[model samples]
Target chain A: MNVPLLNVSGATRRFGGLVAVNEVSFEIGPGQVCGLIGPNGAGKSTMFDLITGVRPLSSGSIHFMGRDVTQEPAHSRSPMGMSRTFQIVRLFPGMSVLENVLMGFQPKFPDGVIRSLFGIGRLGGQERDARQRAYEILDFVGLADRAGDRIDELTLGQLRLVDIGRAMAASPRFLMLDEPAAGLNDAETNNLAEMLARLKADGLSMLLVEHDIDFIMNACDKIVVMDRGTKIADDIPARVRTNDAVIAAYIGKRAHDAQH
Target chain B: MPLATKRASVWPVVAVLALGVALPFLLSGGFQLRIAMLIWIFAILSMGFNLLYGYTGQISMGQQGFYAVGAYAFALLQIKLGLSPVLAFAGAVAICAVLGLIVAYPLLRLRTHYLAMATLGFGLILNGVANRWIDFTGGTAGLTVPPLTWGGEALGRTGIYYVVLAIAGVVFLLHDFIARSHVGRALQAIRDDETAAAALGVPVRRYKLRIFVLAAAIAAVAGCCFSVVSLRVDPSLGEFHILVSMLTIAVVGGLGTRFGPLIGAAIVTILPQLLLQFGAAETLIYGAFIVLFLLFIPHGLAGLVENVRWTRKSAAPARTAATNVLEVKG
Candidate 1:
């Protein structure tokens, strides 16, 4: 009965003549673990991009904590407690692992040119606090020992965790992860599930987009099924498991392909 | 740990400053002192260019425009208005900062080659104005600036050298501080991956504009120093002659490192004079040397030093890995 922490109403995006996303509406309450499951080319990633301001929506609105933020830029959205991880694991390769997390603390610091020049005021204290917090987040993500290592030296699974840690450093109320478990092995995927559960218990709202059905089935409380840019079902996992439309659109093809 | 890092940095700067301050005394000759003064002036120019291209990843070919503006501002203040040289120099740098801010809004939006060409155009326009506006700028004949004086005594070559060294020291400290600060880290993030930096809440456009203005102001200071030491300002200061903007001391020594520009300026300034012993062949030899350096060492001497350190550190791990792989093969 509480107002959702994040609300998307009639959100739509188009590229040229093709409709990438069509009036998709969803809500995520605080501490909710929501999964966005879809077949290939179902526009899930595009929807995440639209919500995160990486790509502008053609129409509709996104609201976070009762404030309309449809027109806000990505950087402005971060201070409002919205953060996202990339599908391709984009990071500052030349920077140290600790510095990668420190980058996420940028919005928290007062970035005034004059204050920076004079080295006066609260910026000095804020910078010191931000660095300390970054180290703590690096520790939380289990990369404390590798904090001084360059990002390029990290493995794919480790890089994914770093990306998640970087987002966590922003201390977001809502985190949208784009395929966090895509290339992770069984053990790594289990570790990620544990991390996500811990984050959810801490009252973080998460929209997880993943192709790993078993991981999502275990981790997510609710599932939203999409096929060909339209939501086919939204319900608790038990109901979603037996939904005819979801079965027809996703499970049916997956089962049929598995037989061969 | 922070104090240790600070001490490590401080010692080198102190040593360099002492060397620079004692140079004129050690030489005692007028011509050599004048050349030393010139080296310091160019070092300032190269340091400014490093902030733009090396730190901020913005290709700027219009540094000469700001440089010329400072020179002309000082010339007008001292020559036509008969103002004091010290105050005029300060006024010139301030005026250049204002002009830089105005220019940055439109030009900083351009990227890579377009930005370079746009700045190149700006320099050409300033050159044209200086040449055509004969009454104000002295046209192609050039304008003479009165020598800076302290208490009715003109600053001789030694005095000028010391003055330049002092300015260079301040600029170097300022550069070092900015390069290590939050803004510098943000700029580096932007340079490495702007999209990622933006996602993390870095104001990309604003930081770019800030660097552009800062670089312009630094170049303006260098120009003022040049005018004072040489006692002249010319339209050719705005002209892109001798590949002067491209041969910036920062690029020749190392792009992003703090001390690279000073080392680069020293080499570029002294090498040409040294090569002059070969008479007319000196110009040919100088061009050939520059070509070789650019072709073989794109990152320059500072990059070479970094490469050496990296290789030494990486060798032990590499050797161990080779041996382990051979054992596995057996």
Candidate 2:
């Protein structure tokens, strides 16, 4: 496909005696939304960790935008146009939603202790520009009105959206979302799906790890089915839905037989 | 992100500065100006301390060590080398700043309580040196110096107060500007969550190192000022109790607020003087006050002020409470 944006081959991760993700392989192309889905303990989170450099793989290679990032640390990867959201929404506390997003653009902020103290070198102007852009990002995520709200003031659904808004503020060419739909109600999930559609239209590539199989089926351009640390199926949503292995993995053999 | 917050903060700073200038003239007692100087000195010292512990989230328990060194360095230079007072002050500040860098490079590598313990040890070591190194430090009896002078002229109580206030005022303004800057935002992010801050490419160690050094330098300046006012330097200045008192001011003033340190400095500095009769139980009172501030008003006086402002702003019951939450939390 189109000189894949990310190339993963035989990505494996082991925790002591446990093989968490065993030789799973996948790729996502330019402007494609790839969904990684599995039941609990299926190594979905582990795979996300490996790809984002949160944890190093026991063995495997991760190439993002053509360069290998397998050895890169988590912090270093964000500057190379890669951004991620944690499953539990780890945001900067004691900051407004707007400041939280502004923090995402910290790499762009100047490293000037003296300059900041003196209010020199267009410091105020730079912050003004960053704040303006942050507001635009908030608007893009449909949380423009909640920009001034505190972190604790927002609901769980809104907090997830704020996390996405923060992720987008980094101006990443590629984005990774870990359970963006976790703990979301039907309405919140639908809102998230719509936002993803808009993001794709904006020409941003994303890899989302999610548990809502129906939402994944609806939102992904391609789907990777993971079951117990193994890549069971990789195909378009319609085809992956009908695959016997996929049905068998989701609902055991007896349940699969009843379903057929 | 509008200037509503920025614009609103300017007036309080200006008003406070004006009060500082006018307070000396209003005082009539012989030692009243000294009390004001004490407040001014602590406010300046705690501003830097606030930047380190309050803003950067690196709680240090060894600052009194730096303060003692600063006083000793300034006192020793003037007394031993017979250097000019102003020059000695500058050299003394530089010396402690270098020490901060040396200590922070190794110590800041440890997080939270470990770093705190390392710093406390550093302070204790310096204090021990001051006590035992009799030839240089004059032992626990201390080394007395001539009165603080600028150029060749001696500064009186009023002159020193004005000079200290001017310098302290400039520092306060810088602290205000910093609290509003993007760098301030980065520090808060570092405080809130280091991993997340680094994910945004915040150069976490560099900022930590910088703030630690800055705080140390300020503590040194405070020590230097103390020697200038008292005309002596001793081991007592670097004691553990002094550091606790310093911490109390930072907490009581407000951890991260721009004006918190100054308010805390005033409360802790002045309250102890008011209760001078209870000299034996001074540490006991400090412990009680800190525990009270922590249990009931952990946010300190700054939080109290913000709450007061919020209640007043919502007198008409206008914007949602959430708006004010961010305005103050930010």
**C-alpha lDDT of all candidate models, in order:** 0.77, 0.81
Question: Could you give the CAPRI-style class of model 2?
Answer: acceptable
Across residues A131-249, which tens digit of lDDT does each residue of candidate 2 receive? 89898988888888887766767888989988888888889989999999999999999999999999999889999899888888998999998887888889999999998888888
**Cα deviation in Å at residue B107, candidate 2?**
3.3
Q: State residue B62's C-alpha deviation in candidate 2, in Å.
A: 1.0
True contacts recovered per prediction: 0.39, 0.46
DockQ of 2: 0.31
lDDT of 2 by residue, B157-274 (tens): 8888877787788778878877777788888877776666766767788889998998898888888888877888789999977887777886687777788889998998888787
Q: Where does candidate 2 stray beyond 4 Å? A: A1-3, A115-119, A228-230, A252-260, B1-8, B79-83, B276-296, B308-330
Instruction: State residue B106's C-alpha deviation in candidate 2, in Å.
Output: 3.7
Q: Candidate 1: give the clashing pairs.
A: none
Question: Top lDDT: which candidate number?
Answer: 2
User: Which pairs clash in model 2?
Assistant: none
Off-target runs (Cα >4 Å) in candidate 1 are A120-129, A251-260, B1-11, B81-83, B242-248, B304-330
How close to the true structure is residue B88 of candidate 2, measured as C-alpha lDDT? Answer: 90
